[model samples]
Target: MVDRPLSLYCLLLPSQKMIHRLLTTAVRGLSANYRDVIYYRVKGGERLCRTPFAVFQERESGKLSPKARAAMSPEALRKQFEALSGKKRATYAAAARKNRCEIDLRRKAFKQASLSGFSHFIKTTRQWTDLGRRAKEKCCAETEKIRQAAKVERDKMVEMYYSGNAVKH
Candidate 1:
C-alpha cells in the first residue's frame, strides 16, 4: 500500500495524531534548521512536538569512512568523488552586505505599485461583507419560505386524508 502524501499544514491540524518528516540530509552542528526534537501527547488532545524541532538525523554519507580508507589509495578516493559528482561538499561564498545591497538595487526597484491599492482593498472588503450579508439574508428567506410551503402542504395532506379525497396510490 502507498502512504498518502502529508501536507505541511496538516501537521498542525486539531485532531491529527502523527506527523512524519523524511530526512533529506542531516547537516551537522547547529545551523538554523538543526536542533534536538521531542514529542508529547495530551490526555484529551493530540500528540505534538514538545521541544525545539530542528530536523536532524544520522546522515548516511556516500563516501567510505577513514577506517575503511586504509586499504584504498589516493586514486580510489578521487574515483569515489567523481562518482558522487553533483553533491555539494561545501557552503556557498557569502557576498558582502554592500555588494548584496548593490545587486538587489540593480535587480529591482525600491518601491513598487500594486495592482490593488487602498481603494481596491476597501472596495473588496466591502463587497465581501455585502456578499456575505446578502447570502445570509437569501438563505434565511428561502428557508422560511420553504418551511411555510411545507406547512401548507402538510395541512392540505391532513385535510385530504380526513375528507377521503385521496387513495393510497
Candidate 2:
C-alpha cells in the first residue's frame, strides 16, 4: 500500500458523519456548472433550503379595468409585462426561487424512483418467468407420456375390433 499525503486545503469528515445537502437553486446551479459547491448558512436560521415544488409569477398589472388592455398587441403586452415587473413585483422572489429549486429536486427524485421501480420489477419477474418455463416443460413432458400411453391402448383395441368383425364376416 502506498502512503498518500493529505493536502492542507482538504478537510475530511469521519465515515460515520452524514451531512444532508438541501436542494437549492445555488446547489442546482453549481451542479449544472459541474463545479465544487459551497453553501452559506441561511439568514436568521440554521435550517437549509426547503420549499414548495410549484411557482407562479405574479402579474404586476394594476387593477385597471380589463376593458382597456383587452386588445393589446404582442409589443404592447411585452411593454405591459415589463411595466408590471418594475413597480409592483411581489416580495416572493426568494420563495419562488426556492420553490423552483424544489421542483427540480422533485423531478430528479421522481425519475430516480421510476428507474429503480422498473429495475426491481425486472429482477423480481425474472424468477417467476423461470418458474413458469420449468412448469411448462414438466406439463409438456407429462402430456407426451399420456399421449403415448393412449396410442398404445388404441392399437390394442384396433386388433380386438378386427377380430370381432372377422366373426361377423
Candidate 3:
C-alpha cells in the first residue's frame, strides 16, 4: 500500500489550471473576432438586403390610384352591392371578370420577364398551370365523396339513445 502526500497529489494542478486558462482566453478571443466579422456582417446584411417580393410590393403600392382607394366601410359597400339592380350587378360582374383577366395577363408578363431570375418559380407556376382549376376541383370533390356519409355516421354515433348499443341486462 502506497500513501501519497497531499502536496504530491497537487503537482499537476498548476499545469491543468494554466491549460484551462489558455483555452478559455483563446476561445474568448476567437468568439470576439467571429462576432465582429461574421455575426455583425450577417446582421447588417439582412437589414441591407431587400427581397424581390418586397421591392415588387413597394413599387406596386406606389402605383395605386387615389380613385381606386375605397372610402366607404365594408358594411356600407356590401349594402350598396346588395341594393344594386340585376343589370348593374351583371355589369359589375363583367367588370370584375375583365379586371381579373387583365391582372392575370400582367402577372403572366411579370413572370415571363423575371423567368431568368426566378427559374424555380417559373417551374412551379408551370406545374400549377398544368393542373387546371376544374381538374383540381374535381379531384378534391372526389376525395371528399365520403364526407357526407362520415357526417351521417357521426350523427348516428352521437345519438347514443337511438343507436341500439345500450345494454339490456
Clashing residue pairs in candidate 2, if any? none
Model 3 whole-model lDDT (C-alpha atoms): 0.39
Supply the TM-score for candidate 2. Answer: 0.25
Check candidate 3 and list the clashing pairs. Answer: none
Q: Model 2 shows how many backbone clashes?
A: 0
Better of 2 and 3 by lDDT: 3
Could you tally the backbone clashes for each prediction?
0, 0, 0
Predicted candidate 2 versus true structure: per-residue lDDT over 31-101, tens digit per residue: 42111111112222122233311112123223435675465454765555456553233433455566457
What's the lDDT for all of these models? Answer: 0.31, 0.34, 0.39
Rank the models by lDDT, top first.
3, 2, 1
Q: Kindly report which residue stretches of model 1 are placed more than 4 angstroms away from their true locations once superposed.
A: 1-131
**Local distance difference test, candidate 2:** 0.34
Give candidate 1's error at residue 60 in angstroms.
Answer: 82
Alpha-carbon TM-score of each model against the true structure: 0.20, 0.25, 0.28
Off-target runs (Cα >4 Å) in candidate 3 are 1-72, 117-169
Which regions in candidate 2 have their CA more than 4 angstroms from the true location? 1-69, 84-96, 117-169
